[model samples]
Target: MKLMTKLSMTTLVASCGLASAAVADVKVGLIFSLSGPGAVLGEEMRNGVELAYEQLGGKLGGVDAELIYEDDQRKPDIGKQAAEKLVRSEKVDFVIGPSFSNVMMAVHRPVVRAKTILISPNPAPAPLAGEDCNPYYFAVPYQNDQPAEAAGTYMNDHGIKKVYLLAPNYQAGRDVMEGFKRTYKGEVLGEVYTSLEQTDFSAELTAMKAASPEAVFAFYPGGLGIQFVKQYDQSGAKLSTPLYTVYTLFNGAANEAVGDAGLGVYASTPWTYNLDNPANTQFVAAYQEKYGTLPSAFAAMAYDSLRLIDGSIAAAGSADDLKAVRNAMTSAPFQSVRGDFEFNTNNHPIESMYLGQVEKDENGQYVLSNQATIVEHMPDAYAGECKM
Candidate 1:
C-alpha cells in the first residue's frame, strides 16, 4: 500500500509541473462599429489590431491569444449588449474598443463593473476623462477634445480671429467644440450642430458661408467628413474661407476619398503617416503592404493598443492579474508610434498634438504633412475631476 501511494504522488506532481509550464490562452474581446456609419474607421482599427497580432506571432504575453470581435453597429445599446456578452458569456480577459464616443459611454459601465481591463483605441469622451473615470479604463488614443484644442491653438497662433464651428449634435461634438473654445481667443462667428448621419450639409454650408467667418472648423467624421469636405469644396466655401478641422477632415481614409478637395486644408492630429519614426515607418509600410492603403490615426491607435497590452502583460508577468496589468498599463512600458506617450491620472494619454496641412505629394496623393507641434504633452482638462 505504501509503494502504491508513493507512485500516485509522483504522478500527480509531474502532471502539475507540466500544467504549470504549459502556455495558457489569453482571450481578448474587440467591440467596434463594424457595420455602420463608422465602418471605415472600424475597418482601419481592425486592420491595425490584426497587424499587431500577426507581428506578435499570434501570441500576447507569451501565451496563445484568442480574439473575438463584435459589431456595435454604431449604436449605444448594441455596444452595451456586445460588452455584456463579451464579459458575461465570452469571458474575455481584456476588452478593446467601441469606436465612437456614444457607444463607449454606453458600454463603459458594464465593462468596468466586470473588472475587465478596457483599453480604448478610439473614443475618449469627456465624461470618462473627468468625473466618470474608471480605474479599469485606459485610453491609448488622445482624448476626444485634444485634437480640437490643438486646432484652436494653431488657429489662434495663425491670427485667425473669427471662426465658425460645426459638428454633429452629440456629446463628443459638444466636447470638441468646448475644447476648441477653451484655448481660442477669437470670436466664434456661429456654431452649428447637425444630425449625426446627415449627409447633406448644403444648408449649413450656405449659412456658414453667409456668416463670412475668417475660417471654418468642422468635426464631421467618417462618411460625414467625406460628404462635408466634398460639399464644402463644391459650395466654394473652401475658396472664400479656409477650412480647419480635427479628426473628421484629414486622415488616410478621408484623404483617399476626398482626393484633391482636401488639399490645402489644415487639421490637428496626434499621429500622421508622415511622422519620421522607425516604428511609424515600419507600421505604415506593413499596413500599406497588408491592406493596400495608408494607415490612418485610427489604425495607429489600434496598433498602439495591442503593443501597449503586450508591454503591460510582460511588465506584470501575468495576463490574468487585473491589478498588475492596470499598474503596468499606467506605467506605459511600450514605445508609442506617436513619439512620447504617457497616461495622466485619469488614464488618458498626455501626448503631443500636431498641426497638419493636407498637401499633394509628388505622386499627387493627398497627405497630411506635420506643420508644427500644436500642443506638447497636453493633458486633458478633466483630469483634475477624476479621483482615481
Candidate 2:
C-alpha cells in the first residue's frame, strides 16, 4: 500500500511539470539611447526588436515572449533607473542593451548584482571586456575598438598621413581615437573633443581645415555624424581632404539626411547590409519590408541578440530554470546576420571587421556600399588581458 502511494505521487509531480512547461512566458528587457543625440540609433534598435518579435509570431521556443522596452536618453543615470525597473519591477528574464558605452557601464553593475543576463547589442568597451568582466554580461556586436583598429590599418596602408582626429568628449569616442592611433603611424595634426550632445561642428571643421591635415578621422555617430558630414561638404573640404569614419556613416536616417555629401567617405564596421550571405539577404529583405527602410548595423545587432536569447531558452528546455538558461546562453551557437560569430573569453563577439565606403546604391539611396573586407577573425584588445 505504501509503494502504491509513492508511485501515484511521482505521477502527479510529472503531470504538474508538463502543465507548467506548456504555459510559461519568456520576458526580455530592452534598453537603448532612445532620445537626444543618439535617438536615431535607438530608433533603429527598437524597430529591429519589433521586427524580430513580429517574425517570431510573439513566441520563442513555443513559449510566448514579452519585450519591455525603455529609453535611456544616452544618460548613465537614466540607464540605471531603466535597468532597475526592468530587473525588479518588470521581472524580465533577460536584459538586451544600453547602446552607448557610457550608458552600458552605468547599468552593468546593477544588472550583474541582480544575477540577470544582459546581452549588449553594442558597447563593447575594453574595460568591461577585461577587469570588469561578469559572467552574466555578453555583447552581440564586435568591440568598439575592433572596427576602428581595422580602419587605422587601412588608412596606414593607403598612405594617409597628417590626419585630424575628431570625436565626442566621452569614453567610447576617446577609445575609438586611441584604437586608431594605435595602428595608424601617422602625424596627428590635432585631436579635438566636442560635446557629445552638440550638433554643430562648424568651428571644429574650420579648425581642422586650418590645420591642413591630409585626412580626417571623425567618431561622431547618429545625428552628430549627419551634421558633421553635411557641414564638411558645405565647407568644400570634402573636395580635397579625405574624411574617414568608424560609425558615423552607416545609420539609416543619417545616411539619407547627409545624402550626396556622404559619398566617397570611408568607414569601418563589423557588419553591413550588402554582405553576400543568405542569412543577411533574407534579413535585409524582411527588415525592409517590415520597416520600410534599410536596417542599420545597430538593428542587425539587436535582431541577433534576440535570436541568441531565444536559442538559449530553447536549449535550456525551460525559461523558469535560471541556472540552466544562463548555462545555455553562455554556450549558445546561434546564427547571426553577420555570418559566423562566437563568444570570446570576455563574452564579446569574435568576428570580422570591414572597411566600407559610403556611396549611392543602384536604387539611388545612400548606403554603406562597396565594403572592402579588412580583418577576418579579428580579436578585441581586452580579451587577452582578461584572466577569465
Instruction: Name the best candidate (by lDDT).
Output: 1
Query: What is the C-alpha lDDT profile of model 1 across 1-388, one tens digit per residue?
Result: 2233224323543543422213437777889787867888887887798788778766777766666788888999999999999999988889999788989999999999999989999889999999999999999998888888888888888999999999999878898999899989999999999999899999998889888999999988788889899999999988889998885557677788998788888889888888888889999899989888778888889999988888888899987786898898898998888977899999999998988889987777678888888878999889999998
- Candidate 2: residue 139 Cα off by (Å): 1.0
Q: Count the backbone clashes (under 3 Å) in each candidate.
A: 0, 0
- For residues 293-353, write the lDDT of model 2, one tens digit per residue: 8888888888888888878878989777877877787775567888857888888888888
* Predicted structure 2, TM vs. truth: 0.91
Model 2 misplaced stretches (Cα beyond 4 Å): 1-24
Please list all clashing residue pairs in model 2, or write none if there are none: none
The local distance difference test score of model 1 is 0.85
lDDT of each: 0.85, 0.82
Model 2, global lDDT: 0.82
Which pairs of residues have clashing backbones in candidate 1? none
